[model samples]
Target: MDDRGGAPAPPEKISAVPVRHPGRWVAAAVLLVLAAMLVHSLLTNPNWKWAVVGQYLFAPRVLHGMLLTIELTALAMAIGIVGGVIVAVMRLSPNPIVSGIAWLYAWFFRGTPVLVQVIFWSFIAALYPYLSLGIPFGTEFVYFDSNKLVPIFVGVVLGFGLNEVAYMSEIVRAGILSVDRGQTEAAEALGMTRTKIMRRIILPQAMRVIIPPTGNETISMLKTTSLAAVVAVGELFTTVQLIYGSNYQQIPLLVVASLWYLVLTSVLSVFQYYIERHYARGTVPLRARGFRFGRAQGGLS
Candidate 1:
C-alpha cells in the first residue's frame, strides 16, 4: 500500500514506557514553608544583638588565638600527611614485620579517643618524669627535662598528628587499592620497576579517589583542633572561653568564635570543590555547550 512512490509502511505501535512523576510542586511548597518559618524566627528572636558581637570582634587576644588555631591546623596537617603516606606504604610492604608494625599503629591510634591522647601527651611527665635519648646499645647522650616536653604546641601537634595519621592511612590505602590491577600489569610488561609503576602510573590514577576524602579529613581536622581548648592551648575556642569567663558576654563572644570556624570551613569547602573538579576532569560527563537550564536547541529549520 504505497501512497505515492514509497514501499508499504510498517504498522503503527504504542510505546509502553512509564512516565516519571514530577515532584517540583511538592518541593516548592516545602521550601516556601521553611522560608516563612526562618523569616518569622529572625523577626521574633530577642538575642539578635549585633552591637555586642561587634564590640569584641577585633580584640587582640581573639586575633592572636585565631592565628594560633590556623598555625596548629597547618602544622598538624603537614605532619599527618607525611607520616600517613609512610605508614600507608609500610602497611602495603612486602615485609611482614613492617606491615604488622604499621597495622598496629593504625589500630591503636584509631581505636583510642583523641582527647585522651592529648591529655596523656600534655601530662607525660607524670609517668616518665624524664626523657633520655641515645642509641639502644649505648649510654644516654642527652637528657631533657620532662616538664619542658609537654608544652601546649607540642601537646596539640602530637595529639592531632598521631590521630590524623591513623585516619589518613586508611584513606591512602583505599586510594592505592582503587587503581586497576591491569594498570600495574601493563606497567610491568613495559619493563617498569615497581617503584616507577607506582609513582607514574598508579598514583596519578589514585589521586582521583584520594583528593576528595583527604579534603573532607582536612576540614574535620581543622574543627577537631578545638579539642585543644581542654588542654588550655589558647586557640580560638579557649580564648573565647577566657573572654566570656571574665566579661560575662558569653553568647556574643562564643558567636565570634563560631563565625570564625564557619568562615574557615566555608573557604576550605570552596577549595575542595575546585580540587575535585580538577581531578574529575576526564572521568565525568561535561556540561553540554550552550545547554541552558535543561533546554536543547541547535536543530536546523
Candidate 2:
C-alpha cells in the first residue's frame, strides 16, 4: 500500500533475461567437424577393405565360427550363473569353514588372469596324465587320458566358467546384501528355513540387483571367448585368425570379427536394457526408466 493511502503502486515487472555461453556453440561446432572428418576417413580409407569385410562377413566358415562363439558363451555363462549362486550362498554361510572355502575359491580364481587359467587348463595333461575316479588312494577305478577327458573346447569352457564363477559370486553376494535385513528377519519370523528363505523370499527380490551386472558379464564373456583361440578352439576369433593366416587378409578378417562382436554386444545391450526396465518397474520414475544409452531429457542445467 502507498503511504498516500490512495492505491498501492503496481508491482515492478521483472525483465528476466537468460544467460548464454558462446563457448558451448564453439565446442559443439568443433565436435561436429571432428565427427564429419572421422566419417570421411572411414569411408575413404581403402586399406580398411570394407569390400573384403563384406565378402567374409557371412561366409560359411565365419558363420560357423560365430555359432561356436555363441555356444561357448552360453555354456560358460550357464555354468557361471548356476555355480555363482551356489558359491554366493556358501560365501554368506553362517559356518566359518564354508565361507572360508568359498572365499578361497574366489580369491584363487579371481586373483589370476583368465588367460593364464585358459593356458593352464589347456596344458593340464602335462601335470596329470590320467584322471581317475575311485575311492581315494585305497581303491583304484577306471582312469581316462587327461587329454581325452578334457578336450580343448572343454578346457576353455572350464577356464572361462571357473573364472566367471568367482566374479559372478561377488555380483550375487552384493545383490543379496542389497536386500534389506528386515526382510530376512521377517522371513525367519515366519519360521522359514534359511534355504527356503533364500530361494523363495530373498533371491527373487535380490534379482533386481543381480540382473544388470549379470548381463554385462554375459556380454564380456562373449568377447573373452576369443581367448580360447590360443588353444585352437574354432570360435569366431580363432576362425578369423585361421582365415587371415592363410589368405594374409589380416585387417579385413579382423574387421569382420569386430563387426560380429559389435553386433552381438549391441543385441545383448538391448536385452540388458529391457531386463533392467523390468526390474525397475515400480521403483524408477516413469520417464527416467529408459535404455542405458538414451539421452537425457530437458534443457542443460
Candidate 3:
C-alpha cells in the first residue's frame, strides 16, 4: 500500500449468518398433533376388532387375489407402455395422416370414461356375435365367437391398456419435448440420421423426465385394476366382494383388500424412491453428513 501510494484498508470482519427455518417448527407441531390424535383414537375406541384384522390379514384366498392383482397390473402396464411409445412416435411423425390417426386414437380413448370402455368391451358380443379378422374385400382370415374372444379378463386388459396408452402417449411426448432443441440440432450437425439421433441421443436423455411419470402411471394402473371388479374379473376387490357376499363379513373382507392395496402401493413407492434416487445422481449436489436446526447448528439443549 505504501509503495503504491494508496491508503491501507482496515482488517475485514467475518460474521456467521443465522439460517432461518421456521418450517421445521411447524412440522414438529404437526407431528405432535397427529400423535395426540392417534393416541386419543386408540384409547377411546372400543369396537376396533384386532382379532378379526389379524385373522383376515394373511388369508390364503386374499393372497391369491393380491397375486392376481399384481399379474394384471404388470400385464396391463407392459401393453400400455409399448402401445404408448408407438402412439407417441406416430403423433410426432412428419406425415399428417400418421399424426392425425395417432391424434384421433388418443382423443377417443382419453375422452371416454374407462368404466364405460370396460362395460362396452364386456358386452361386445351384443354388437357382433362373432369376431372376425380379414383383409378388406377378402375372405375372413380368422373367426371366433365374440363370447370367447372378449372374456372378462380380456375386457379389463383392453379397457385399462387402451386408456392408459392415451395418457402415457402424452407423458412420452412431454418427455421427448423436454429435451432441448439444441441437442437435436447438434446431433444433426454431427451427421447423425433422425433415427440415430432419437435412438442414441434423444431417448437416453429424455429418460430422466420419462421415468418418474411412468412409475406414477404404473402405480396408478395397479390401483385402477380394481375397476375390473365391475366386469367380474375376480381380481382383489372382486374376490373380497365374493367372500363378503357369501359370508357377510363385509368390513373384514374389505379391510383385507384395502390392506393389500396399501402393501402394493407401499412397495411401489419404495421402488419409485430408489429409481428417483438413481436418476437424481449427478443432477443434484450432495451435502455434508450433519444436522442443522433452525437458526443454529444444533437443536435446543
Task: Score each candidate by Cα lDDT.
Answer: 0.86, 0.93, 0.85
**Is candidate 2 or 3 superior in TM-score?**
2
Ordered by TM-score, highest first, the candidates read 2, 1, 3
For model 3, how does the per-residue alpha-carbon lDDT over 101-158 read when each residue is reduced to its tens digit? 9999999999999899988877888999997899888889999999898887887888
Give the alpha carbon lDDT tens digit for every residue of 1-301 in model 2: 8888888899999999989999999999999999999999889999999999999999999999999999999999998999999999999999999999999999999999999999998888999999888897677688899999997888999999999999999999999999999999999999999989999988988989999999999999999999998889999999999999999999999999999999999999999999988877888864575434434734332
Query: Ranking by lDDT, best first?
Result: 2, 1, 3
Clashing pairs in 2: none
Give TM-scores for every candidate, taking all chains together and pairing residue i with residue i: 0.84, 0.91, 0.82
After superposition, candidate 3 runs with Cα above 4 Å error:
1-31, 39-46, 189-191, 286-301
Clashes in model 1: which pairs?
A: none
Model 1: weakest 10-residue lDDT segment is: 286-295
Which candidate leads in TM-score?
2
lDDT of 3: 0.85
